[model samples]
Target: MKQPLLRYPKALVLLFTVLACLSLRTVTAQEIRIVTEELPPYNMTLNGQLTGMSTEVVQAVLKEIGVQASIQSMPWARAYDIALNAENVLIYSILRTPQRELLFKWVGPVAPTHWHLFAKPGSQIQLNSLDDARQYQTATVKQDAGEQYLQSKGFTVGKNLQPSNKYTYNYEKLKSGRVDLWIANELNALYLVRQAGDDPTETLVSALSLPDLGGDNGQNMAFSLKTPDALVERFRQGLQAIRSDGRYAAIAQKWL
Candidate 1:
């Protein structure tokens, strides 16, 4: 005779399995997919471990909400793609631009970031307006806000915009005189230059301010459209809980 457990109806077993996967009370770490990019101070790999301001906040939120998830760092384009189309996918430290407003359900304004166009120290690239930057070649990461913003401003690839897959490559290209400018966030510019053993004040100059990407919700934790509203709300509340208890501030103080 079959064991008591096997004797149960197959339909009942499937119902329990479905509930385990779908119900937040029984959701496992592997059920939700978290994705991010190597955006330093926000999200990055340090000594082979993933730990950053936004990463910490996300971890705290998961703990508060009684859920578990592992974060995977990848290229920004790939990470954005996954978060845009995949079910139950979470993306973090992403700029909440107007173009991306409705793309994902948001949680927290993890941190504020300032956008600017950076040029080499003593560079003659003076830009009073975005149109004045039309003649210059700017280095940008593929699918990054910089590239997207430039594209919206009529900067064509292979002409005025040079898009690469890695943020580090932009620095290399700028130093090599291959690109006249590189648009990036203030924190990212400083962190990358410092990481490269160069002083940002001496190596990079802010040529232009990108006000369009600034103001509110500079970066946020977001869930794909396919994710259930309840799950998103749970995370939203979890984030709020961390903020109220000073956990979020602690993480920010540690990194920023």
Candidate 2:
């Protein structure tokens, strides 16, 4: 019987090399599913297209890695759940908090966002701290970082915290005086107010800054824990490349 050629030392090495290359190619070729919400300036749908600061950054990273992905906009709760449970999932503009640090593989500081406690203009309510805000009804999108942050601080949903599936509804509740305070991203809150045909500067007043409520660090693109480390590292390198090449800055300028 003739010995198998692959069993030879040199042939075995070559076979292993080919197998490794094939494995890498297969991983790179796998499709990545991106999930985001309609939070303008970060991720949103415009003219039936998905485009925003974080979206552009994500696209650039994917392009750098030669991978293609389409961003899907859905309710925060659904998106969060999917990203948590599914493989090859990427969620952008996610606050990288201590509680979430170990849950997902992170790829960025894609954008900046400051949490604010917003009250209708001229409202007597004032929040100097998270505890102060707890005294009144606070509106937040369900499963959002803001909601999670507040809950972590002991604000119970359906009691002090008013959880809405839609962020627009939270803004509406604030504008209608149904909720005393709206815990939201400053830029997102302004965008929502402007989209609702109201001047944000006049319609909503920032009563307090909730810095580090979720995380003081900038927002990031996070991948599911089930995602391969090699794939996550590829994205991280791609993001770094964009940042060093001025593509990241240019994209952010377009939105900011």
User: For model 2, what is the C-alpha lDDT against the true structure?
Assistant: 0.86
Residues 143-242 of candidate 1 have per-residue lDDT tens digits of 8778888898899999999998888889989988999999999888899889999988889999999988854468889999988787788889999999
TM-score (C-alpha) between model 1 and the true structure:
0.89
- Give each model a TM-score: 0.89, 0.91
In candidate 2, residue 1 scores what lDDT? 100
Best by lDDT: 1
Q: Backbone clashes per model, in order? A: 0, 0
lDDT of 1 at 169: 88
State the lDDT of candidate 2 residue by residue for 50-123, as single tens digits: 98888888899989988876789998889999999998899987888877889899987898888888999889
Cα-based RMSD of candidate 2: 2.3
Each prediction's Cα lDDT score? 0.87, 0.86
